[model samples]
Target: MPWSPALKSTLRSGLHLERTVTEPFQVLRGMLGVAIVLFGALALGETGLATSAALGAFIAGTASYQRSFRPRPVLALYAAAGLSASSFVGYLASPWPPLYVVVLGLWAFTAGLAWALGQTAGVVASTTVSVMLIVVTLPENVPEALEHAGVIALGGVVQATLAAIWPGRRWGARRDALADAYASLAHYARRLRHDPFASFDPDPLMNARRAAELTPAQARRRPSELAGMRSYAERIRPVLAAMADPRVGAAEEGPQRDRARELMGAAAEILDAIARSIRSGRPAPIAERTYRALTVPGSGPVLDGAGRQAALRLIGLLAEASDAVEAVDRGDPVHGEANAPGHLSRPGLRQLLPVLPHALRRHWNWSSPVLRHAVRVGVVAAVGEILGRSLPFQHGYWAPMTAVMVMRPDFSQTYARGVARLAGTVLGVVVATGIIRLTHPSAWICAGLAVVSIGGAYLLMRTGYAAMSTCITGYVVFLLAMGGEANTSTVEDRVLLTLLGGLLALIAYAVFPTWQTVRLPDRLAAYVEAGGRYSAAAVDAYAEPTEHSRALLRAALLEHRQTRAELLTASEQAAGEPVRHRGLHTAQLADARSAMAALGRTTMLMEAHLPPPQSSPVPGAAEFAEVLREQTAAAARAIRADEPVDLHALRDHYEQWAQWLPTPAADPADEPGGAADLVYRDAGLLVEALEGLDSALNS
Candidate 1:
C-alpha cells in the first residue's frame, strides 16, 4: 500500500505499447533500407541475392535506428562490414558441419562480448550473429562466399545512403526530451503541494535525458543541459518537503505559509511554461516573472528558524532554475563549462591497445552476465547445430539460430522470447503457406512480398517483439521460396525445427540460468562506492576550489554515471526474472531505485552549487566538507553491509547549521554572508534524503 508498489506498477505498465513505440521515424528508416536492397536485387535479375542483401541491409538499418553524434554513414559502415564478415564465414563453412559448428561457437563468443561494451554495439553484434545463421543455409560454392559477402556489404551501403537522406528531426527530439524533464518537475511540484513525502518517479526524466545523450555532443540540446535540468528538479524536491513540514509553516492564515504556497504555485507555472517552450521551440514566457517572484523583496516572510532556512534554499534553487530555463530560451547549453560526456569514449588505436588488457580483465569472468551469456549461447548453439545435422532438418541453421535468438541473459526474457518465437513461427508458416497456395506468385512477386514482409517486420519491431518476429518469420519463408526452395516439405521442416530450437533454448536456460537479481547486491555496492567518490570530489572542490578539483569532480561524475547505468540495467533484468528466482521482491527493488535516484539528484545539486575560485574561502567550509565526505563514505559501507546508516551526528550538524539564520533577522535573505549558510541548508536537505534512504533500507 506504500509508494513502492505504486512505483513498481508504473514501471511494469510500460510492457504495453505506449512505451515501446517511442517514435515512428525508427520504423521508417528501417523500411527504406530493406526496400532499397530488395528492389536493387530484383533489378539485377538475381532473386537469390535478395536473401543476403536484405539481411545485411535490415541489420545495418536496425543498428543505426537511433541517431547519434557519430555519423550515420560511419555506423552504417561498421554494421555492413560486420555483416559481410559474418556472411563469409557462414557460407565458407556451410558444407562442413563440424567446422561450421566450431566457427559458429567462436562467433557467438565474440559477439556476446560486444554486449559488455554498450547497447548499440550489442545490437550490431547480435544482428551479425543472425546474419551468419541465415546465410549459412544459402546454397553456394565455397568460392562464392566472398561474392555473397560483397553483396551483403552493398546492402549496407544502400542503408547508409537512406540514413543520410533523412537524418531525422534533431531539434524535435531535443524538444521532446527537455519537455519530458520539465513536465516531470511540474508533476513533482503538484505532488509537493499535497504530500511532501510523495514518491519521486525519476524514470521518465532520466530516460529522456539518456535519449538526449545518444545525440552528438555538439548538438544544441546537450547531455549536460539535460543533467542540469534534472539537478534543478531534484534540488527542489527535498527543499519543498522541508518547507511542507508543519514545523516550518505557521498555523492557519500565517504570512510565511501564504508566501510559501505562492512561491510553489509560481514555480509550478514557470516549470509548465518551460515545458511548453521546449515543445514549441519558443522562450519560457514566465521566466522573468518567476525570477522576480523568487527574488522579490521580503520573499522570505517571518517564520521559524528552520522555516526561513527552507524558504531561502527554495529561493536560491528557483533563481538557478530561472537562469537554466532562460538559457533554453536561446537554445544554449545549460552549463557551458561542463561538456556532455559521451556514453562510450572513442579511443585512438594506441589508446585502445593499451587498455585492452584492463578491459578484458574487468569483463572476462565467470560471474559476468556477458561472459555467461557467451558460454551459454555458444554451447547451446553448437549442440543444436550437431543435432540438426544428425536429424533430417531441411534448414539446419534455423534450429541453432532459433536457440541463439531466444536464449537471453535473463531467465524471464529467455523464456518469453522462446514463447514469442514459437508463436510467431507457427503463425508465419501458416500465413506463408496460405499465400503460396492461393496466389502461386512468380519469383518476382515472391521477391516483392519478401521485401514487403521485411519492411513490415521492422515497422512493428518496437511495437512488440512478437509482432516483429511474426513478420520476420514470414519474410524468411517467402525469401527461401524465391531462391527455389518452396516445397511443402521445406515448409514443414522449417516449422518443426524452429519449435525444437525454441524448446532447446528453454531447457538450456532451465538447466543453467544467468540471474541478474543474484548479483544486485554487488551492483548496488559498486554504485554506492562510485557515488561516494563523486560526493567526495564535489565537497573537496568546495573546500579548495581549483582546476584539479574541477577535473576530479568531472571524472568522478563520469564514473558515477557508468555505475548508475549498470545498476539500472541490473534492476531491469531483475524485474524480468521469475518471482521464484528473484533475489529481491518488488518493494525492495523500488526502494533501492528510490535511494539511488536521491543520491544522483543530491550529487547533481552539489555540482550546480560548486563554488568558483574564492580569494578568502570560509573557514568552516573545510570542516563541513570533510563531514559531508565522511558521511558519503559511511553510506557506501552501510549499503554494502546491509546495515542502517548512523546519522545522529549528521542530524546534529544540520541543527548547528540551522542556528546560523534565525527568525526576524535583519535582511535574512539578502545578507552577504548568507552564501555559506545557504550551502549548509542545502547540505542538510541532502543529509535528510540520505536518512530517508537509510530508513527505507531498514524497513
Candidate 2:
C-alpha cells in the first residue's frame, strides 16, 4: 500500500458519515442537563460561571453517550471530577510557563495510558486534558480558579442528579444489548439454511455478556426475562451449528437435512420474536405454525441419530426462551442464583480501588501499545503547547486541544480524526461567525444556541467522527460567544490554529508510528495459542468428564472467542496502514485465518458430542491432550519470535495416540456416531488444521 492511496482512503473513511439511528429522547435528556447549568448560571448574572459549568455539563453528557455499560450517572460524575481536577491543576500551573508545560505533558501521557482501561475511560480522560487547556485561561487568580473549578464540578453534579432522578427507560442499554445477541442468532439461523457451514459472529453475544455484568444493587432488581435468556442464547448457538453441519448432525442430502433446515427457519422466527419482546418490553406472540414446526410429527418422516438429538435440544432451548418472555410479561421475580453461568459480576465503584493499580501496571511495560501511545501523546502535546504559545494567536490552547483530541493509538484513527477535526472546525467557525454577524445574538441567545448545538452533537455521536466533530465545534463556539469572544478574527484564528494542531498531531504520528503491521504476528500467535487451549480442553473432557472439566472447557472456549475477535480487529486496522512489515503477507494471513477457523470449528463439532459425566474414559485421551497443549504452546512461541511453526511432532504424536485408541465394533450399527469414533475423527481434523497453520506460517 502506497502512502498516497492509503492517505486518501483514511481521509475518505474519516469523512464518511454513518447512518446511525438517532435517539431523540436520549438527546433531549442530555440537553436538559446542559440547559440547567447554562441557563441557571446565566439567570444568576454569572456569565463566567455559566461558561465553566456548561463545559462540564456538556462533556459529562458526552461521556454518558460512550459505549459503556456503567451507570450513566457514574460516568457523568467521573467525567466531572476529572474535569474539575484538571482545571484546578492547569490554573495553578498557568503562572509558570515551564512548569505548566511539564504538567501538561504528564497529564497528556496519563490520559493516553487510560486506553488500557477501555475506550470509554480513554476518551473521557482525554477530554479532561482538552477541558483543562480551555478553562485554565479563564480564571485570573487562585480564588477565582477555585470558584471556576467548583462550578465545573457543580455541572457534573447537575447532570448526575438529573440522570439519577429522571432515568428514561431504565436498563435500556442492557435490553438493547441482549436483543442484539438474539437478533444476531436469528440472522445466523437464516444464513445457515443456505450456507450450512457459515460462521456465526460472536461480537453481539460478547457485547451482551458485557452488558450482563452487574453490580450487587443491579442484580437485586434485574428483570426476570433478562436473567436466563442470554445463557440460553449462548447454548443455542453451538447446537444450531451442530444441526446444520453434515459431518456431525444431518446427512448431506436426505430427509434429515430437510428437517434441519425447517427447524432452523422456525428457530429464526422464534428468535426474532424473543428479540422484539426483549427490546420492546412486551411479549411477542409466537406464531402457531412456528411452534408446530418444532414438534416431531407422528405421521411424517422423522429425524434420527445426531440430527434428532440436535432438534430436541433446539426445541428445549426455544421453549425456555419463550417461558422467559412470558415471565417478563407476568412481572415475575428473577430466578436462580446471582452467580449463575453466563451472568457476570462487576464490583462497585469503591470496590474498584484495590483493582486499579494492577490494571494500570499491566500497560506500563514498553511492549504495550498503550505505553508507546502515552509517550507519543506526551511529547506531541508538550511540543504543540509550546508552539501554540509562541505563535501570535490569542487562544493558543486550541492547538494542543486539537492535537490531544485527534491523536489515537493507531495510525488510521489518528490521521482520520485529524482530517475530520480540521474540516469540522472550518465549517463550524465559518457558520458560527456568519450567524453572529447576521443575527447579532446576545449573551443569553448564545447560551441557548450552545445548548442546541450540544443536543445536536449528542444525536450525531454515532454518525462518524466527522459529523459529531462538527456539532462539537459549534457547541464550543457558542459557549465562547457567551463570554464575548465570537468575532470574525477569532474565527480565522480558530481555523488556522486547528489546521496547525492537526498537522502537528499527524506529523508526530508519522515520525513515531505504532504500525499494526508489526503486531500482526503477535495477534496471530495469540489466536493460535487460544485455539490450541480450546481444542485440548475439548478433548480432555472425554478423558475425565466432570463438572470441573466442563468448566475449564467453557473458559477455554471464551478465551478462544476473545482472541479470534481481537485478531480480526487487528487485521482490519492493519489493512488500512501503509507499512508492509516482514510479518505475514496477504495470502499467508488468509490461510492462517482459515486454519484457525477450521481448528475452532473442528473442536466445536467434537464438543457437541462430549460424553456424559461418569461415562467410560477414552484410553490415552489425557496423554494426547497434554501433548496437544505443549506442542501448540511451543508453536505459538515460535510464531511470536518470527520463526517457523513446526507441527510435525504434533502430527506424529496424534498418530501414536490414534494407534493406542480402542477399536470400534465390527458392525457400524452397533455404535453409530459413537463418542470414540467422533473423537478420533475430530482429532485427525485438528491435526490437519495445525499442519495447515504451520504451512501458512512457514511459507
Candidate 3:
C-alpha cells in the first residue's frame, strides 16, 4: 500500500485534489446563463431565452478556443444564422408552428440554391445547414418557447452585426489590430537579432498563422491594409529567412548581433509606417529615403564591412518595394495595374472547375446528411408532442437538433463533444436539484446562473472532449427552471436527454464520416505549385538594386505561408484516412516547409550585393530585367517541383531581355505596363542570376 516511486513523485508535486472542484459562485453562474436564455426569450421580444443562451454560450466558447475573434465578418454572420434558426424552431413549436417551419424552410432552400450558384457557396452552405437542423429540433409549446426564441435571435443579430462592421464603425478598432500586428512583428525581429537561429523553429510561422487566422477581416483587405494580408506576409519572409540561416545564428560575435539588431530596428520602422497608413486610411507611401535604403542584402543581420553595405542595399530594396506598394495604392503605373508586367500571373478560375470535384467528392454525405437531420427534427418534435400529451411535462424538437448540433466533424470530435455533453448535462441536473432544494429560484437567480454558465463554457471550450458537456449540463437545469416553476426537481430528464443527444452525435460522426476529406492527388498537385512559387521567388531575389529584391522576398514569404496552411488542411483531410499513412502526410508537410524556408534564406544571402551598374544594356535590352526576373523565378520552381520549367523558352526570353536593357531608347514611362523600374545598376545584378543559370545549365 506504500507509495511507489512514481506515486511518490506525484505526491511531492504539491498538487491538491480539492483544486479540481469549481467554486460555488462559478457553478451558480453556469446555471444562470442557461436559465436566462430560456427565460430571457420572454423579455428579449423574439429569440427564445433558451435559444439565446445556447447560441451565446456556443459563440463565447468558440471565441475562447480561437483566442480571439478578429476573423469576424463571417463568424458574426454564422452566429446570426444560429440565432435565426434557434428562434424559428421556437416558433415552429407552439402558438403558430407552420409559420416557423415555412420561414425557416424557405430561407434554407433559397440560400442553398444560391450557394449552388454563387462564389461564396461555402458561407451560404454553412449557414443554411445549421439553421435547418435547429428548426427541426425545436422544443414544442414548452411554455413561452416562442418568446424565448425571438429574444435570443434578436440579441445575437444585434451583437454579431456590431462585430461585423466594427472596424469601419467603431472608430479606432482597425488601427488597433494593425498596430498590434506590427508591434508583434517588431518584437519578434528584435528578439531574432540576438539569436536568429535560436528561434529558428516554426514558432514565427505559427504565430503569423495564428495572427492571420485570428485578426478580424479589417486587417487583410485594403490596398493600404497590408495588401489583403499578402504583403504583410511578403515583408516578413526575408526576415524569417535571414534569421533561419545557420551562419546568422552561428554568429555569436557581438558586432554581428548589433548590426542585425540595427537592421531589424529599421525594418520595424517600415512596418510601423504601414500600420500608421492603415490607421489613417491613407496610401502607405514608401518615402524616397527608405525606398533608397533597401538595396543591400545579407544572409543574416547586417554585419561590419560588407554587412553594412548589405544592410543599406536591403534598406533600398525594402524602400522601393514599399514605394511599389504605395504606387499600387495610388494607382501608379510604374509597377503596372493589378498585373506585374512581363510575367502576368492572373487568376485562372476555369482551372478551379476541375479542382471543385476534388473537393466536393469527399463530402461525407453529398445529399442525405442534411435531409436526415431535418427528418430527425420533425420526428423528434412530433413524438415529443405525443409523449407529453398525456403528461404534465412539455416537449419539443430541441432534443433532436441538439443531437445534430453537437455531432462531430469526424469521429474524434464527435466522441469528445458527446462525452462532454453527457458530463455537463449530469452536472447541470445536480445544479437544478440544488436550486429546487433552495426553493423556487427568482429571475435574478436565473440571470446569475446564466452568467456563470457562460464563463464556464468559455473556459472549457479549449479543453475539448469535456467542454460542451460540462457547460451544457448546467445549462439544461437552468433552462428547465425558467418555466416559472422550480422544475429543477426534474433534473433527471434533462440529463437523460443530454445523454441521448451525445449517443446520436456519435452515430452521425461514425456512420458516413464526411467532415475532413480531400483527394490526395489534388493535394499533391497543389503542393507542387506551392513549392514552385517558393523557388521562383527565391531566384527573383538575386536581382540587383533594391526594388526587385524586395518583391521577390515578399512573393516568397506569402507563397510559403499559403502552402503551409494548405498542407495542414490536407493533413486534416487525411486524418484517419483509410488508405494513407498519417506519417507520410506529416512528412509531406515537413518537406514542403523545409524547402520553403531554405529558399527564403538562400535568396536573401545571394541578393546581398547592391553594386553600381555596369554599362547600359545592348540594343533592345530594356526589357531584360523583367524577363530575367521571370527566368530566375521559373528556374527556382523547376528545382522544387515535379513540374519542369520550359528551360529553352525561358533562356531565349532572358537572352532577348538582356539585349533590350542597357541600350534602352524608349521612355521607361511609355515602354510597357507593369515593368520593374530598374536603372543601369539594378539590371546589372539580375544579369548575374540569368547568366549564372545559363552557365550552370545551358553551357
TM-score, per-candidate, Cα-based: 0.79, 0.97, 0.54
What candidate 1 gets wrong by more than 4 Å, as runs, is: 1-29, 66-71, 198-254, 279-358, 488-490, 534-542, 545-565, 579-699
The most accurate candidate by lDDT is 2
Q: Lowest-lDDT window of 10 residues in candidate 1?
A: 336-345
Give the per-residue lDDT digits (tens) of candidate 2, residues 1-699: 778988998899889888894688889888999999999999998888888999999999888878899999999999999999999999999999999999999999999988988899999999999988989978889998998899898999888888889888888999999999999999999998898888778899989989999876787777777887898898898889878888667777778888889999999999999999999888999899998898878853356666667778789899988897888778676655677545688888788877778888988787777888889889888998998899998788888999999999999899899999888878887887778878989999999998888888889888888778888888888888888877635677888888888999999889988888888888988999999999999888988888789889999988998999988988888889998867679789889999888888788777766777887777777878888899889988998897878889988887777675577544323453454574556788889989999888888
Indicate the residue-level lDDT of 174 in model 3. 36
The lowest-lDDT stretch of 10 consecutive residues in candidate 3 is 10-19
lDDT of 1 by residue, 1-699 (tens): 233553344234323342355356767777777777777777887776777888888777777764343566667878999999988887787678789889888897787777675657666877787788878666478656776788889888988887778767544555676677778777776776666445555555555545445332334334333445655664565566556554333333567666666667777887787677666655556746666666656534555455566667777776777676666556564443324432323443355477656765787888887788878888888888888888876777778888887777666567767777777777887788678878888777887787778777767767766677888888877877776676644567878888888888878876777877677767776776677677667667766777888889878876777787788888776665553323335576578667766666665545544456653344455566566667767766776665666656766775675566344334433432234533554456566666765666567
* TM-score (C-alpha, index-matched) for candidate 1: 0.79
Residues 197-295, model 3: lDDT tens digits = 432333343443434332222232323343343334334544444432434222456666555565665676676665566556565654555433343
Global lDDT of each candidate: 0.67, 0.86, 0.44
Clashes of each: 1, 0, 77
Pitting candidate 2 against candidate 3, the one with the higher TM-score is 2
Native-vs-model 2 lDDT? 0.86
At residue 478, give the lDDT of candidate 2.
Answer: 85
